[model samples]
Target: MASKKHNDHYTDYFGITDKKVPFEDLDVHNDTRLFLDPHLVRLRTSPRPYWDQAVKCLDTFLETLTVRVLSRNEDPGDLLKHIQEPPETHLGMARHGYRGHAASDVIAQRIWESLTTDLYSLFRVGLLEHIEDLPLFVRGIDRDITSDITTRVFFDSLAQFTMSCMRQIPELSSRGTIQIEKTVWDPSHKQWAQRTYTVPKNNDGSGIILIPRGWVRKRLLGSASRFLQTETLTYIQHSRAQYDHRGKLVTPSKKTLRKELAKEPHQANIFYTEAAKRNRQNLIAQFWQYVDERYTEKGPNLGDGLARP
Candidate 1:
């Protein structure tokens, strides 16, 4: 006789009884497609309630990895050895002032100057957390190509790689990458400036995918929400006029201050959004360093670890 198995409506297991329901019992809606994958959903509607906290988490993670690498006594002596040798023929133009002004020396100097300016521009706005780029620049001055490659590999390998790997671990599976872009709001400019990026994505083989204005706005809004929640210290400024106050005890309306404070969140949002974009570029720079370093030693470990978590 075949074993008898009753198709009961409910199964008695754990604390609750499982009620048998038809497969079609669940309701399907248009929104279902949007939330199919959590990462896709978060990417689409980032800056969720926990985004501020998430950014803090991300910042801490980055800092920890950076400290770990910097603290280590193990030096990548290979990069130094490589720096001793002249670059290949491909770098001749780069060495001989092909991409700058005046003589090759002037061009090189200008190139370095411009690069430093751009870097400082990013740093002033808080995109850069540390000043390690200066050391990297000094190391790579003579052999620009090799030096650039070396530094790039180091950053990427250290942070991006770890982030990529951590995401795979069971506890962090739900976490996704944070991305940022930039947009200029000045009305007078003939051509507007804008940029988009995917955090964590660029570390992998895939680069930051630039999206449209609509998407950029969404990203900013989300990131702003995150920033306000995390950075407890409020950012503010005060200005006083000399000549105007001499006339009398003239007090500007408290209403104006209130209005400005109210608007601060919006302004802060824009500032941080732009900040995130600059940071993205720095992160990308570090990623390239990781790539260069890996190839220099191992010749090419093109496995899964290349993409940062």
Candidate 2:
């Protein structure tokens, strides 16, 4: 049986929640509701296409802020204290910025990776193990329904992961409209470096929604697809539009987001939801064949005698 629950938590507490609430009635697709995890946005690995640009962006962004703040001769702790004060809350150091200590940077990197990639990696591995063990439970399920249920379980776990990452990265929120939010202070410029985004409104009453830039949408979703079903993966990608550049998120699109947003949620309950119907059907078919082969009179029933008198 699928665990029906996962170790993941809501992305809002991490300072990523959608700013604009969509209307009650618009039909929104699942893919448009996503956002990236800030923790996962980092300098790329060596020899990669974006590696140079990634390094330049990070170094420039960090250096610009550090030089300005260092001029104060203020202790790091005092700076944290001063910036943390109310009214100027907008100017403080967020989890994504350089906080002046190598150790802090290392720790932050660990935390970032653990929450975003590490968490999902573990979840996927666990799911694979569960799927491998699923045959044990399939015997109790109906021939017509087992595969469908298991596949739904598989995709639902992926969807949950997508919802989570959408809440982590802020840029996916304002895909078409340019809005800049100052995230870190720059002493040299006597100002702040703002993160920019593009937001577009839907024709329906649901109002403004975020979409990923053409390129980003292609990349992350491409990566997510290998482990998930096509439509289910696309739905997760579309939901990514929840994050705007400032690391603040927006509400997810209603159609796809509702399952994750439900009260007293059971992650497995998603298998029973309408959104998962097709995938569930596919799952049912796939597992049914396995059950037939393994439990039939000629097939192995490795555990059959152990439970009998």
Candidate 3:
């Protein structure tokens, strides 16, 4: 006799045969490349209290981190309290994503050092309003890394968010729950703490979550993609721009811009950051607006992604 075949998709397990589900109906068997974006969280409308709590958890820690990094003297231990390997929510693009992935120590230390050194210097000239923008200037950080950090810092809120989602759907809420432990921050006591939440779990025993479609993008709004599109690029263009005899702007080709960007004198974070500061107000507004208008899909179901012949 053959063993029973179960659906790996959350909706399928929950008996949903609909073409589309409101939340991200995740593939419970493996990790997806989608990221949990904070910008989208702020814009979310459903599950009001959960989104609010998620925002609070994220902001409280990030604000503290910014202040600590700016202080340049305090031990980063408290601020880094919740910085650790995130519990696999079966959401992210790790190489072996279902197993979960994150650089435990080096990333934490590097972010701390950058905040104190390079980022602090950049702040003096012009500050990025969203820490989500760090990947553009920070050497090795990317969306996946930030997503991991977000999951670690805001685990409880997300767990609760999942709770809210599960309760709203009958098939899931009726399925009962499993208890799981996650390391999180104790904002009141100013330390790290272990916390537990009852949530739906995978056969692999990892907890699963359904992110709101509104609170995610197929590709996150990353600084690497948008950095130059902002006024910063205008600044870079002007600085490297050639002038006609009459002082008319001479547009540089992409090739020219690349060559200039590669040159030693033009390679420092200072030049770009300084230019960014010149239009700081506009830069902040434009980036958020770009997030609002682009990428976030309205109506579609994510296919199983494992396409084959």
Most accurate candidate by TM-score: 3
The digit string of per-residue lDDT tens for model 2 on 1-309 reads 112132211122223355442111111221111122111222113223333333333344334324433343222322121121111101112223111112233333332333233223222322212222222212222211222222121222222232333455543343322222223433344333443222232212122222112111111211111112322333444446577788876644444544453431222222322233433333222333433343354322222221101
Against the correct fold, how does model 1 do in TM-score?
0.19
Q: After superposition, how far is residue 142 of candidate 1 from its true place, in Å?
A: 13
Lowest summed lDDT window (length 10), candidate 3: 300-309
Q: RMSD of candidate 3 to the true fold?
A: 6.0
Models 1 onward score TM values of 0.19, 0.19, 0.79
Distance (Å) between predicted and true CA of 207, model 3?
A: 2.5
lDDT of each: 0.28, 0.27, 0.61
Superior candidate under TM-score, 2 versus 3: 3
Model 3 agreement with the true structure over 134-207: per-residue lDDT tens digits: 66567656667777676776677777777776776666654456887877755565456788887875555456
Displacement of residue 38 (Cα, Å) in model 2 is: 6.4
| Count of clashing pairs, candidate 3 | 0
**Poorest lDDT segment (10 consecutive residues) of candidate 1:** 26-35
Give stretches of model 1 more than 4 Å off.
Answer: 1-103, 125-299, 303-309
Kindly list the per-residue Cα lDDT of model 1 for residues 1-309, writing each as its tens digit. Answer: 111132111112111123331111111110000001111122333323233332333344324323433443243222222112111101112323112111233333443443344333443444445222232222223223323222222222223323333343322222244444433111123122343433332112222211111111111111222233322112211113223545753443434534554445434433433444644433324433554454355532232234322
